[model samples]
Target: MRNVILCVMGVALLSGCSWAKNVQSSKNRVYFENLYFPARLSTNSDDKQSFTVSVDRIDQGLAPAREAGRYEATKYCVATYGNSDVAWVAGPDAPDSELRIVEGRLQFEGRCDV
Candidate 1:
């Protein structure tokens, strides 16, 4: 009797979930040319507007990594300050020689222009 009840509960739980659907929505998926690059944005403790974005796996491609970093920084500024204007200290528009890449990761620095 206990086994029968457990089996029914498990089936009920499984019915509510869809295995075919993507775990992450398209809106949240960050990718360049179907390749997903991991990016992280960190804000300064003393100044919330100042931020640094790091995108990993430069071995994949530099342009994509730069786009990923730009995307992350833009997302952060928009979310925090309700604006997209950014005063980049070191950003994507710079020439290749001016860009900073350390240990296979691209780095970007900026402050939200509110």
Candidate 2:
């Protein structure tokens, strides 16, 4: 019985590793300047048309962070609204002084236009 239990534990550990790999690969990620920036897009539960894109690791490069945020916002708009039209409230094209960064993450806000 102990040998059987050990075998089952081995199988479970191997499967867990593969499952983690699959989950990591399934994430929609963007590469910038040969590096991957972790960008995420989130929408307000009360207002689905408005969204925010946040890119982490801004210390690496501002240009890459901006591109990552823009890419994520575009992807979110396209996926949620079936179009890539976004009216930027605070976007990548804005001047450097206007960009929003908080806690090492750059954020962009926009509304998806139908």
Candidate 3:
């Protein structure tokens, strides 16, 4: 009986997290809603301050991938920058082409007037 209860409880708990996964913004107010990363930025960085900004600002980098990537584009936010590969633009003129997450960086699609 105990084992059965544990299994039911486990399943319930797992599903609960999926429903509320993307509840808060990232360090830069970038709004990480429904984005999945092998290692979350919160655990992969050294600076504690950078962890607070939710807005993802790729101020300096090698170069944004002009070409699309491999991963399914995550449709959310102003823009996303991760492993730093592709940058999908989510603006009024957003194109019909689907973006790929080359490394882990993402570009939110379907813009709304801010």
Candidate 2 colliding pairs: none
- Candidate 2: TM-score? 0.79
Model 3 per-residue lDDT tens digits across residues 40-114 = 222115622222112122222212221111122322222343332323234212443553233445333321122
* Residues 23-68, model 2: lDDT tens digits: 8996755689977889988898999999899889899999988998
- A best-first ranking of the candidates according to their TM-score comes to 1, 2, 3
Worst 10 residues of 3 by lDDT: 48-57
Give the candidate order by descending lDDT.
2, 1, 3
Model 3 misplacement above 4 A: 25-114
How many pairs of residues collide in model 2? 0
lDDT of 3: 0.32
The most accurate candidate by TM-score is 1
Q: How close is candidate 1 to the true structure, as a TM-score?
A: 0.82
| Tens digits of lDDT, candidate 1, 1-114 | 999999999987786564424454545778887788899999999999999999898889888888888889889888888999999999988999999988878999999999
Local distance difference test, candidate 2: 0.90
Select the stronger candidate by lDDT from 1 and 3.
1
Q: In order, how many clashes per candidate?
A: 0, 0, 14
